[model samples]
Target: FLIDCFVFFQTFFSSQKKMSTTSTGSRLYESSKAVDEYIQMHYAPQDQLFPYDDQYAPSAGFQFVARTATLCVESFDKFGEIREGETLSALDVGCAVGGSSFELAKKFATVDGFDFSEAFVKTAKKMQLEKKLTYSSLQFGETFEDRVVSLPESLNTEGINFFWGDACSLSANENVSKKGYDVVHASNLLCRLPKPKQFLKDCGEWVVKPGGLLVLVSPYSWLEDYTAKEDWVMGLEGPFEALKAELSEKFELVDRKPFPFLIREHARKFQYGVSDATVWKKKCT
Candidate 1:
């Protein structure tokens, strides 16, 4: 039954893609204010930030945060147990709205968060500095509702920094290339890049330290607008084998599992899917 549902969705989505032909390249988030706003509202919602009268909007915020927190811990534990008082650093590549990054900051001493969208990074920075930011969600076609999003007043911002960056072109970014972190977390970012293979190789070589951990999660939703068909890692083979092939030389796969997440489009509609998560320990060079 589940397989049948999956097949139906694939066919429906593929037809939709065919019907909506915008261009050959992915619509970069930098150009889309609506996309950035939607991402912020989707990932970084806290119930306390919204008014009691509008509680319906933030219905999934707690669940999103809880799942992100679990992924952070699982990413760290899959590598090894951390000793008490031991300082560690993490690099959250493609950390949209800083949900997972904030979760990582709680576990590690330092976390550097990066996203390609200027709007997302700016909003994340504002939230870190001010503890709150206002975002909006679509109420109906051509209509939107305003809401405030906040982080725990207790969340430590001293250990976290949000930056705008491209994961595929990490070498040019001094902060990510020079500062090797104990863990590099790339969540739902692989299939979105135009050159995912290069990003995977560059991340293994520069971002993660020797004997460190690399955690990747993706839905394999490869769209021609986001990535060219030839550039996709999931082709004749599946995402598992494709990732293993890309990271095999410098990293060893430790665990593979399914990660479920929910994205609320509006009060009445929600999108839920499971992302394939793979954890790898960087091998000693």
Candidate 2:
């Protein structure tokens, strides 16, 4: 049953790629507006996200980042793969503003947060150095409010290293070249790459060590501006099917589920999205 469906979707989406040209992706993370919005989404309390009523929002602002890392610990424990004294390390690909990296640091022994946007990387490093950042966010039309984003208490940020990097060409990164991680986490980043297929091919093949895990979260929202339709990992069959096709060579699926999240654009307006999160264990050769 699943085989026939995947074939149909693959064929359908392949043809659709030829007909579509415009993309819905916005690659403006380098902009000041994008930086501020991410800052608020990463560090702001529930009240700022839902100014009218904090209780109305789901319990997942920066919590989504925390949950993504926890999924790794849970998976290892489920499989009895948790080493008692092994020094675990993690790589956070496309770690915008360092929310997910900081969250990973709480659990992993060391974490490397990598992103393409210099602005986002700089801000994340700044937060690590200064422990806080002040930014302005749009309330309605022109009204902007100044807010401060502080690092969460009790997190030892000493082991975290932030880097400006391109996801598609990760080999250029010095740390990635030195050694692979015990786990690699990439959230809401697949469909945005200019060449997502390359990233899928490299997940366990290069970045993750043998018997390690690769955690991915994505809404599968493909945009031609960011990625050519021909390069989308999720075709008509959706991300997981196409993802399995690419990753089956070196990885096997361990767990998958919906990971819902919210991002604040302004006091009144917010962007709500549900990303599918999946965990894969690299095959031991």
RMSD of each: 8.0, 8.8
| Winning model by TM-score | 2
Clashes of each: 1, 0
Candidate 1, residue 172: how far the Cα is off, in Å:
1.0
lDDT of 2 by residue, 1-285 (tens): 000000113344443432211114343445566667667767776666676654676666446665766776676556425557778888888888887788778777789887877777889899998889998867877788898878866779999998877778887777664568788888878877887777767776778888888888888877676777788887578678988988988998888898887766556666677888889888988
**Candidate 2: clashing pairs of residues:** none
TM-score, each model?
A: 0.79, 0.85
Leading candidate by lDDT: 2
- Give the Å shift of residue 280 in candidate 1: 0.8
lDDT of 1 by residue, 60-151 (tens): 33355346546657767766545456578888887766767777887888889887766567766877898876765555565666666667
Question: Whole-model lDDT for model 2 versus the true structure?
Answer: 0.72
lDDT of each: 0.66, 0.72
Residue ranges of candidate 2 with Cα displaced over 4 Å: 1-27, 58-62, 79-85
Candidate 1, residue 187: the lDDT equals 71
Clashing residue pairs in candidate 1 are 26-225
